[model samples]
Target chain A: MKETKKILLNSRPEGRPGDSNFKFETEQVSEPKEGEVLLKTEYVSVDPYLRGRMSDAKSYIPPFEVGKPISSLMVAEVLESKSDKLQKGDHVVGMLDWKERQVASAEELRKVDEDKAPLSAYLGILGMTGLTAYLGLTEIGKPKKGETMVVSGAAGAVGSTVGQIGKILGLKVIGIAGTDEKVEMIKNEFGFDEGINYNTTDNMTEAINKACPDGIDVYFDNVGGEISEAILFNINKFSRTVVCGAISVYNETSLPKSISVQPFLIKKSSMMQGFVISDYSDRHSEGVQQLAKWLQEGKLTYTETVREGFENIPQAFLDLFDGKNKGKMVVKV
Target chain B: MKETKKILLNSRPEGRPGDSNFKFETEQVSEPKEGEVLLKTEYVSVDPYLRGRMSDAKSYIPPFEVGKPISSLMVAEVLESKSDKLQKGDHVVGMLDWKERQVASAEELRKVDEDKAPLSAYLGILGMTGLTAYLGLTEIGKPKKGETMVVSGAAGAVGSTVGQIGKILGLKVIGIAGTDEKVEMIKNEFGFDEGINYNTTDNMTEAINKACPDGIDVYFDNVGGEISEAILFNINKFSRTVVCGAISVYNETSLPKSISVQPFLIKKSSMMQGFVISDYSDRHSEGVQQLAKWLQEGKLTYTETVREGFENIPQAFLDLFDGKNKGKMVVKV
Candidate 1:
């Protein structure tokens, strides 16, 4: 094909990103150069943390340049190769372009085993998402057996995985999500002990207190808003809070306001820490090995909300902020 | 003496505490009972943490009951010993009443050496203040040599000690205090690299950025409010913050407001944890030994603002919130 389509960050949005902020364009490309493989994109991962990269502000990750193809984690297949490390028909994953087909360097791609797990598992459960849940929970959360663990954004990819790991670690896992559907999924599918739908709950503090009578010992905070305020009020003494993402406040045009957490933190002598998955880069293989073992042993489960085609990638990304996807939001290109 | 005068928590204050909230009462006692020793107060320690106990709110320590003598850490002389573990004329430190004389259990008092250091040094440098600074810095801050460590409330007992320990560990110490006098004391007496007077500076963020050009790596937070928010904004990526106390908010009747810190924490991937000195109770001897050795070797220097007589205890405690004392505030009886 002479034409290839890709999504570009046309402009940085002031608040929540829109379709206008993203510009889609087609370009002509020949084939893979020497030491590069022509990869056909199979799955594109849309993560909430990507919103941080959209702004020019300093963050753990660099900002995405305007008028360029937005790059993210994706699972692909080797269609053609000029590199000795990769062969045709091999499955792979890398920070490839949002376009359907692109030439990637051999070192940039990691070969994935399709027979051991489905190809999409490389983007959700057995990939960086799963590792993110594992490292943040075990390293920061440090949940003890029989401790109560509460996770916000419990229906999302990272939150859901964190809940599963919390259960396997023998914690009483409670999840906070936006919708009734998400609440049902968290309790039934994700195996959470209880779920509070923040959208319908009249009083979050009372609801949280009811769900977590023992008080929250380890709080995996994925959403930072009123829900977090409630969780802060309900933390047990010496509790630990692992701040993985703040999807609720990521698109706020103004400063997000809530009850100050310092007083509660001081009274309870608690801890709160934020980290990205890349901080655990050296332990990636270790995390992946453990996650895979859990998956193969039936101790871990995952869900992926897959949309069809490459053109829908931007919408999938935007839907994450709206809490539209139940689990990992991936696009089949 | 058959009668002893001591301070009492008359009632909970609305905002900042005053003399009316504290009551001076005289209590009658016969003599020392079995396993109890008579202790005459030499120096009664007044701390910022005492404000937490004055309120009915839940805290690390129980609130003082109305019409009861408020008890705290005090350096005393054993006047009459009924226990074999203690002897008359022995100087000791214990959680004793703020009075001229009292009876204490043998195990309640730890014999402090007046030969190694001054009688008052046991309440300031070689005591809980020093231990709080030691453990919170070494255990939580975990700062490296040449890293920038910013301490708020730098003129106070705990913060002054923290700054000194930071220097001993080869860190670039920057202190934030309320007055020009304190700023000078932090820089000159404590040997800090820089000091920012929060009282004089209109723009804290700008002032902090000017002082810590390399950005803050470790922050030992003794006062939390705008100062803490400013520090959070200027923290380098992967910084560590030790929340020892929040004196600034201790007097606020409403929720203290500043820019939300969650975004900054997330962007920098930083860590913040709060703690009480007693959290390291099991390792008290470890901290006391190091502090004593530091004092004996002349590696550590200290100052104490002493008020003579028992009736001045409430005023001395109130002065802590007003930032009147340069170092530890103690009542000498």
Candidate 2:
């Protein structure tokens, strides 16, 4: 038996999640069974979407059960393998529990190349985040060349990748970020055509109008609320809005209200669609190949805000709400 | 010379439009020039969407220019024709100025067979109203057979037709209307599977949940306020909501606030699309052919609340906001 640390959901969060919501416990982990592999958790991805699972509300994915161990995408090393598919010391990624060591079925995890890209990239640009940005942009947004595209939460993992892909697709990519530094980073590093600091800007509608003189044809929305409402005013005819994530209102205890989107959508003959990454699982290989090609050409780049140690996982997740991470927030153990 | 009575948009209304916003005047109508035809207005179609054009707000169609004659779909008799395309006394239909008698280009109007259906039918079921219902539901709603479809403003022209179409397409149709009589009418007259009188219901969400026990797979929205907000909660995964109209908020002077749709949309992985009839102009003939076939096969029927006299057109248009009309509201000139 191996001693391992695992985090449990002590209680569901009312609004903003804190340390009280999580309880770290020491446990004895057993060896891998017949078709199982023993995994040592290396990198844990902490995202805003986890907040939805923390609540008991109905959602695309079921809410995390209270008093049970919390789970998310984790990159791990196969320390012991009872399956032929995975060898010892193989690095793998999958939806794994928040534990230092655990045994999982071979089918539950896919091996990743250690030399090809960083292990955490599998949780981000090379995995769910990358596929989400590409598929949502191409399939839903349906962006055309020379069309103006606006991205909300532009400095974050998905937003930055979406903007970069928009640039690659020959769209005039404009990004909206919370900070001036993030705004500059998206424009300068991510190759965005322009950026708006939503925090510093007065009258976002006016700012968006000035930034996109021809109006927005595609909007990849991550931060929905007032920013999304302002973007609605500047949408052109037949615009497509990809509703990716709403980090802004994810933690609201009560029902959040905003200007009705129905009127704006009607006026412009526009469409807004929301999707989870799993919806496009059938086309994952296609997405992975294209993303891998872009990465090889140095056309696609990514950033990571890695937090050290397994004990800090809960705090890393809480930081996502505060916008403390520059890019993908990952806890390395 | 013909003495034509024309209604001019005197001024834009702030909220609810009244007689003060329209000015009636008598004018001399000139003879049709070389490619033009002189038309005598026979039937005038007054619709809720006209309210959008009455205000100087940005919409799919431009706001009617103030101090100019407002126009809509009209069926008229060809009084005199200078072009080979039309003959005298031939009934024609087109978007024409709100004038009793006027001259228009022969190309502007299409000859309609008066013997096949009532002249007024061209302005309702055989015209824009029917096409709006067909295209909006099929193209945007994308309803799957055996799916549950809930329609708001279910007693109005588009809503009534949408519910009927949903039934024809093999969907379980539920309708929401203001009055209990309308709720009964949609179920008994329009052949909807279920009905909910939103005005009588204490909690629309619970009522909708009970009505659409399987959850709403398709929502054809015409009202788009509290009713729509209630519908949002009961949407099934991958649901499609066609935002055909938002008559409830059409007359609002200020921005209308409601529950933010982004969270619900994201949670369901659904889509909401808004479209005007003209967006599918290319598919109009297909829509008309199908509607005409259905009408002739005794599978389809329509209702029109006809108000007599040309001068009452403004009041007829105003009555739309009050839910005074059952289906299509038309005026005989």
Runs in model 1 deviating more than 4 A are none
lDDT of each: 0.89, 0.93
Per-residue lDDT tens digits of candidate 1, residues B34-88?
A: 9999888889999988888888887778998888888889998989999998899
Chain B TM-scores, listed for every candidate in order, come to 0.98, 0.99
Q: Which candidate has the top score in TM-score? A: 2
The DockQ figures for the candidates are 0.67, 0.91
Query: Per-residue CA lDDT of candidate 2, range B40-96, in tens?
Result: 999999998898998888888899999899999999999999999999989999999
Report the poorest 10 consecutive residues by lDDT, candidate 2 chain A: A58-67
Please report how far candidate 2 places residue A67 from its true position, in Å: 1.2
What's the residue-level lDDT of A206 in candidate 2? 99
In DockQ terms, which candidate is top? Answer: 2
